[model samples]
Target: MEKKYPRLQIAKYVAADYFSAMVSWILFYTFRKKIIVAPLYDSVGQDLNDPTLIMGIVIIPLFWLLIYYLSGEYHNIYKKSRLQELGRTIFITTLGVIIIFFILILDDTIISYKNYYQSFLFLWGVHFSLTYLPRLIFTTRTIHKLHNHIIGFPTLIIGSDEQALQLYNDLQKKPKSAGNQIVGFVTINGGPKTPLSNHIPHLGNLNNLIETINNQKIEEVIIAIEPSEREKIQQILTKTKATNVMIKAIPDLLNILSGSVKMSSLFGVPLIELSHELMPAWQENVKRVMDVVLSSVALVVLSPFLLVLAIGVKLSSKGPVIYSHERVGRFGKLFNIYKFRSMYTDAEINGPALSSKNDPRVTPFGRMMRKMRFDELPQFYNVLKGDMSIVGPRPERQYYIQQIVDKAPYYLLLFKVRPGITSWGQVKFGYAENVEEMIERLNYDIIYLENMSIYIDLKIMIYTIKTIMEASGK
Candidate 1:
């Protein structure tokens, strides 16, 4: 039931951080007033109600909170590791202190630079100590509750053989709980013949997984199917890939030998947890922030350029300046993708088709626009609208998507994230002329998705710019 109270627990962390930040700032200010610049306070010691102090008390805590949030410290509050928390707190606090020093305290009227260093070190120490202490306390208490089974994720076990039974017993009887509350079990090959049915109730088969997960409020899924049933793993994974729950598979001898097994506790069942997310939480947050900011700025600054592009397309083509076409977006949701019209009217009257290098339907002006990526500039509006990202797997139309999925079932994984204006595929392989080339280009996008980080996005963008300059894309 504690899992159901996530917001309440999250509020506790935020509240603790807010007050700790406030107290740390107050203490730092007091030290500055009393020791660093004692002459300014007069012989009688000054009133503590200065406007600057009041402002710091109000705004500085918010500043620290913002720092913590952007550093990814406040996310997944219940799943925090104490050791990791300590390390992250120290790192983020140090960074925040440095930023604040440069921005605020560096301009202070200090007698010497030595005093500035002292003030900075003192403030950092106080802030780090105060902030980390409460976090450690809260995290420790939460971990204690988790270990004692007071707070646990609602996990579903998928398998009904001896392996699954043993895994269930091992996790259930462990000295320290792995925080998986086995709500029930699901059998991939039917539950009647399996020994697990004698113990836990079988919820349903893989056919009803999404519904079962939703109805049961499942948070995690443990895949412990036997080696003989390994073929079912792909089907299981495909079915569960779209669900938000964490997916973990039981490791085999090869996995153990390859060092794939990771145990959080001494007796906890080892699991090969699927990589939970593509990028660090902070990078994901920062990417979204950049998307909004950059798209907004581009829309404003490139207004004149967009206007000219629109006029050119209108004059050169017998169609609307902007083309709106349906494309599958994140989680298979369809959205209208906007682009400058790069083709004449009735270019796709036969059906949806990929453009070729020498397609006559593409106007000369349109080809120039494609070479310069001016056709995609309007997608900044799509990014601003949250229908697309600045960088991701380029979305495919349903007609092409069906063909791609038929050739490579894993293409469905691309739907997990928002489509981008420029992708690793587009940068590396350019526009695919056919389904076969599209499938070949799919590998790079998959690589990009697997190792998605800001660095990769920047690298793809650099390549895209080079491609545009070279006029190399098909």
Candidate 2:
């Protein structure tokens, strides 16, 4: 089996973002101390020993991160446009600088109001330039790689008729034109034969579109069905909307001529909109960076605690210190999720079983760990691994997921995002004692999915902390 690459690629991008943000923060802090604030001096220099200055180094980066996240700068790393990213970065950085100035620098003992203004502008320039310059360099390289066909989204055409063939030819002839490199084509109906089979292999017929997309690592889908196939197109669109792939359809000539199509000249080819991006690209990048930095910090800061828990689990339970179990993740891929072993080694000897409040399989330490959510510390690694997020719907085994989907078809929507260590459902409802409670919690998870914003995520995190502190979790 070809290893699924999307999650891994996303993880890599997030890791890059974490490092980039760290560098930016360091640069900004250095600039603030040496250039921006240091100039506010008489013959006798201002006191350098103020704790606020030291604290600013820590607080500024956090504020920047929160601002970047709330502005939706960190949502989807893979599906970002360079122009969109730059616009968002500039906007968020400007806003963040203003906030920082008002909160920290404005009350400084400046020589004049002009000096204050100069200091604010200098800080903004240093931070924005430091941050955006690296991001632009990275994004530009990615775009160049994409345009040169060295790196491209794995795209599949969904129609096999004349239109699909035309699209395939257009894309193949101008590889750099579309940001997508066609891996192959999948036929939508038993209609006209496609002529591009010589260049692109036919993966399958229409009945297996979903399976083909999953198996082929397809990142984008172009629906080339004729206007007459409205019903079929609707069905395909409805089914595919749940998947995290970009969906586009060729508009009729009339619509194109009437200016319904928005075109962009990247490398000299007019590309049209497939669908509105789910999240802005820069926000996606920000989210990844946050995930990586927070996860890494949590792992390191909590290492002593994690070690103690591992030892406790080893002594308390007849099992390995860590438990690795298969759980469904983004786009329904299975990954071995790690957690501190919180149950007996043979807890699942009777096969998969959902834990209840008084399940005999849970050890005393395990129960405490579950209550405080200490068992989940190991999954910070999962967040770093990109198998999960720090915030999102909790992942479940296929056994439970299938059961949930039977009652709620929309359960699959949760798979569109990486499962989280703590979710709105986990925070609000705690662990489900049975399938019924699981379904009930699924409702909140679905709500979180629909109203997914950084603000909502922060709320979930706050509630999660409260739940953990109160030991209110089941």
Candidate 3:
């Protein structure tokens, strides 16, 4: 029975912040007039009706809102941890105050340098208090509801054994609810109904795990399999890799010592929370912004070059100037990936095949374009269209993807991110001539997935540039 008004909660937080930001700016304006300016000039010079005061009242809150949005402050408002939020608020408050001071308050007329410190401290204190107090109130109410079992996440248990039953009982016996409202249990062993069936309905076996998760609107999953069934844990994790639900499992001493798990509660069952997030929220936002901006700029700056490439492609072969093929993208969604055509018309008439170094399907100009990676220039459009990034794992045809998945099930993990025009895989392993080589290249892609960041992406782009300069792509 968790309160599911996420939009409503977000609105509350936004409204609270907007109101508080306006109040803080007004109070700071008044303080500057009364304490700083009045003493120096023997007058409260700026009245409430001043244009600057009105402007601050109008625009300052919006400025703060932009900062909050970019910092990812509004994400998962219902699940916010008060202690974590306190730290985040303080940090962001300090950052915003510094920015505002330099941009808005630094050049103020004052009696001494001490006035600058006074204005900064006063504005920061008021803004932080006004902003954080309302947030604390909202978050505290949500936490109170969760702890009291008035609200909870729809949870599923992913095992059927003595261990699963014990874990279920432990959560039930907790003095304060950890917000996991166990909806049911899914059997892993496919055995007859066990003691767990006495407490909760058996949803199904692993064959329909994802279907069951979707059908039940599951928000959380706990893998509570017995020690004897630990080998099946990888199968369970792989099945749930594409799901958005939060996944947790009972941790062992090895997990604890290896620092693979994070503790969310002091009294609740300790478990290893499996996060599907490849990058932090703010970084993801920034990456998308960079993708759009850089792609837009590249398209504009390279328009003439792109035109020449299009002409070359049209003349080199009877095929279309731009080749568009359906490629699997983020979350297994299909999108037509664009590239300057580098092969003869009907190049894959024999079947979808990976190009080799001396492939006859490649046109003479196309071979040069591939060497210099001019063939990939058109994918900047894909990046702008949101189907890809400038840097990520290269997208593959579903035919090749199926073959890759058969060899390495974890290859599906690559679908978690947008395909890129240039990738660490392409940079490190170059073009794959066959499925075996594609599997060989997947290791670097997996490494990139595990270590995704704006920094890592920039590094991959640098390496890719070097490969293109050396004409190393095949």
Candidate 4:
């Protein structure tokens, strides 16, 4: 069965990053060889070789990667915003070129000082243009897909009153090009005295938000509570503040008119402000492409280990080696998540149960596998299938999600994006032993969501690797 939070296609994203870097480097080299130096002196046109030339080509990309990571460019590859991404790309490219000029190109055998500035300009133009062009193309295609409904993030509305209904109606009337597609509404109070009940499914009360999000596969949550419920709103926000979902506030019409809203649109009806959607359309596309490429490579490279795990599972347990179970994904959709079975055939015969560190039902091999997260390898298939990501908030089961939402209404926010095989929470908190523990870890995930960036993802990845090497995950 397919998981609701399908893993991201990591291969595409890795390929994009690799190719873009290669192309940018090549362009820089060509410009230096064929344009800048060649035009300056006839003798210089002949073959000129520097030992560091090749190294510079290779090293430049390493620098770019470092800068990109520092700039938080790699996180959430699927949800980038084009404008912001372009701005970042330009900044990084310019910085890279300036550094290159002083380190590699400035002290060149130039006859005139004018040549120094010319060379710098040439390198910067070629590198930035080549790098950003491919990124733009890839991102544009993704935005198109989102608008065409070929791809959509599952969204949830957080309020049940008149304001919530107003926001829902406004979003529904928006042009198809709007990126979001609302799945359903989770009421904040007992039952909203609003028109939304007739238009959309009232998934459940606020107390069951996490459960509703898991069951419905929600991706984004729009908080449209009334102004009077400030205290209650804060409580809801506190609960949801931990997940990676997009949280947008429904501002009053005056706020919209006064330009306090960052993003808003008129859909032949009243206007609404979409407060948070951090990345640009293009960056999001680039991120997806990277995910697909990396995941594909990982699957191939780790095939041998996967085979061994399957064999081990077969020998260690009586049931099938691979276990598929329901999981909540982006937009509250349900999908079957794949994993190497880590427990006995009927480990949970009583019902859904959280595994303890020394659970008796676990197979001997399963214990080792859980420690190293080997049981999660098969999830790469989910990434390939576009149900999850390599990095994001980890998906949860409906049972525990309901439990979490009872105490934290904001747990519903996690439904805004695809779940991940590894997340900020997983890297920091590992596995949760119970509902309370899960809620505790939810803080890290929420922080990740609000401060999502490529740099943060790399840090998490590095930490995750460290955890795995030490067998620190529980």
Candidate 5:
């Protein structure tokens, strides 16, 4: 079984980093005080009793910890590759040293400019050495445990053919276990029992894929179906959209040449690791920070405008100032999305419906608000509430989501990310008046998902601003 305490492993690394940072800072301070300052000024003491030392001791370690967190060092601690981690440590350590030099060290009194260079190099070397040694030891211990089968991730094979059998055999026969404890196999097509059944139990098929993943606590999924069965591959991926499992598949020559596949283990069979996560961890965290900050500012800055709009809505039509509706969010969770009422109170008396240009249900003030998107102002609260982001795929009500899913099953993939106040779909395609248009808009959202980053988000926001200024959302 996998270690039940992954947090303990993370804490071990964090403790290592924090301890190393404190020690490195102290060493750098001593070097500055003794070699740099005391030699030049007799009044300067070599003792570590200064307020500067006290402050550095308190702040520098926390600063380094925050950098490590943003660098995503704590994620999937057991699955980290030591070689890759070494490279990452060197790069990040150099970058952090530069930052510290400018912010904390560069202005120090020095005998010559040579001291600055020496200080930078010494800090980088000391920090890197202290940080990497303990990390290397921890990682080596985890890898040794994995190789000895002392710990393993719960893995499931999503195929039942000869390819699946061969994959199972290859992984089981590997000189070192890739930590894949092949718990069972799931069938893709209905047929006779596969050869793999002799080794592992059949969990179920695609119909109950999500249920099986949840019930079995699956951490990794390997799709062993033939590459030629592209439809099956698509189907398997679609069903696993809501799962948090790491997905890998047997790759063809084309995929390899296209650089779509990456090696997860040197000792295990070659396979393409499919990544559903769209953005890097640092950018994802930064985006959330931006969402909170921007949304908070927007709500505060636009309060008077919001009040005016609320008054207009109440006077223009008979309904509450705010409108709320349940929408499907990330991981298929349901949350109430907020908006200023843009339609009459009984606009949807017949049933739920999508608004269109010149829709009779839309009040005169509502149409103008939709064109300028003032009605969406309240959704900043949703962003602040963590139900949405400032930029992402637009959320759809479950009523219309089911309709959209009927035509395009991949729509659920959008649920992998939080819905946003404005999206590439809204920027390019504007509001969708029908399910078909929503599907059409989904192409842009899907593209946005594949290429998500802070840069892409800023680009989308720029275009969304243009749309609002031009009143072109119609």
Candidate 6:
């Protein structure tokens, strides 16, 4: 499926949905004109060719299309399930109906209150039927292709042990195809070899996993090692996390009985899907929107406050007011993060050090700025520049990050999100005075990642504000 006209495949979904919107709107308008509105006293004989009618036909469909795109309905078009598509379509269509009715049709001249409810129900029914039917047809075709072995995703197995061989054989012998066309397998530590190597070619060392993934265009990674090697799972993800490949693992009876496994494929096999995404697609997009809008407004609205702080920092210290430091961001990319100077010129001349409450390096005015959290204001520019977000695990310098990783290898997980100006860790545990303290704060950050949500972010922000107002930096 991915090999043939990949771009056109997604275009087909968009085209089908676009016409669905246009056709549904046309039917609803016709119903309103000929049945619902003609009985009204003033709305009789509404013109079908009016400028507004023509404009709406063009605009409404585009509006629906934008909504679908933002909802991420157009992504992974070939891999979608008809059942999931149906549910998503209903949800988005209902939202669309509410917006359209309020903005476009609430003021319409109607014979009675019944007309309002009737119009809404009619439009909603027409839209849902038209929209869902075509998508279901397209999705059905994709599924049929997969079952017939005409379409498959490139999958790589990450172990060569007994469990790997068992999974490989079961998948091959399954009556129905799961669409995982195995490209090859890799050994984690040259553990006891199995028939897996005889069946599929052994892709080289695990260290070369990324290169092999790119070269073979691997779409999936199935880890089938034993329970003792569970620690290796973290190492594999730390490397392959950047590849955007779907990762799954063979689950033991313990996991299945405990309801820890959420099945993704119902037919050929049962595996635990590893989804590390922090937010749903729509929420992720909205978070970026919030970051841009909020940062832009803060920079503009707080310009006076920022200017005064800049001069105060300059007079209190002999360093640039706006300090730029290189920090590791998402996917381990390094970028210069901006900050308002809160220390003397040679504060870090000896080496990188975490600040103590009474550190002499922090000038008197700098300490006050830290108390008010004013030192982080310049990072709004970083947020606007798309390098950081308003709420995420705080970023650390590479030297410090390396040390932190030594203590907590999962520290690298924080790199999954753009480092924020203030984080749940900063709010809950305050500043770290040493490596041990930083590791202690890591627990709160890990909690934030596991329970990430818009509401959680808002709560962290609220606590951060109260802390700043109280000059409560530790």
Best by TM-score: 5
- Displacement of residue 70 (Cα, Å) in model 5 is 3.0
For residues 1-474, write the lDDT of model 6, one tens digit per residue: 546456888788789888989999888887777687665424434566567678878999999998887787877777788889989999999999999999988998888999899999999999999999989998998888877678888999988878988988888887777688998898887833556888998987577887888889888888787777666766777667656577787776235222123556538588887775777777777777788889999999999999999999888868798888899898677899988888888989999888997999988998888888889999999999888999988888898988987888778678768889889899988888989889999899889987887788789889988998898975
Per-residue C-alpha lDDT of model 1 across residues 79-98, encoded as one tens digit per residue: 88899999998898999899
- In the range 1-474, model 4's lDDT, one tens digit per residue, is 112222353345445656666666666666666665666535533434544556665776677765565455665555666897789888878887788778878777766788788777767777777777767776787766666667777788777777877777676666664556677787765565457888877787767776776677666677777766655665655545445565566655334222124544423433344444544544555556667888899899999999999999999979999999999898667899999999999988899988888999999999999999899989989988999988889999998898998997667778766788899999888888899989998998888877766677678878877878998877
Q: How many backbone clashes does candidate 6 have?
A: 0
TM-scores of all candidate predictions against the true structure: 0.82, 0.66, 0.86, 0.56, 0.88, 0.80
lDDT of each: 0.83, 0.72, 0.86, 0.73, 0.86, 0.83
Backbone Cα, N, C clashes tallied per candidate: 0, 10, 0, 64, 0, 0
Model 5 regions more than 4 Å off:
2-12, 39-51, 148-150, 226-231, 251-259, 307-320, 363-365
Q: Candidate 3's residue-wise lDDT over 1-474, tens digit each?
A: 656788998999999999999999999998998888886434445475689989999999999997887788987776788898899999999999999999989989998999999999999999999999999999999988888888888999988888889888989899988688898999887664798999999999887887998899898888888777777777787767767677787775224222135554425677777766788888887888889999999999999999999998888779689898999998677999998999998888988989999999999999999999999998999999999999999999999988888888888778778999999889989899999999999999989988999999899889888888999888
Candidate number with the higher lDDT (3 or 4)? 3
The candidate that wins on lDDT is 3
User: TM-score of the candidate numbered 1?
Assistant: 0.82
**Compared with the true structure, what per-residue lDDT tens digits does model 5 show for residues 35-79?**
877765455453556788889988999999988888778878888
Residue 373 in candidate 5, Cα distance off native in Å = 2.0
lDDT of 4 at 33: 65
Question: Cα lDDT of model 1 overall?
Answer: 0.83
Error of 1 at 56 (Å): 4.3
Q: Is candidate 3 or candidate 6 better by lDDT?
A: 3
Candidate with better lDDT, 4 vs 5: 5
RMSD of 5: 3.1
lDDT of 2 by residue, 1-474 (tens): 123345665455444445554555556545555655566533223334545555655565566666655565555554467798778777877887777778766776655578677676766666666677767766676666666666667888877767777776666676464457777777665633567576778888766777888888788877776666655754565456657787666655224222123644434434454443444555555666778999999999989988899889999968689899999998788899999988888888878999988998899999999999999889999999888888989999999987886777667767778899999899878889788899999999988876776678778889989998999877
321, model 5: CA deviation in Å? 3.8
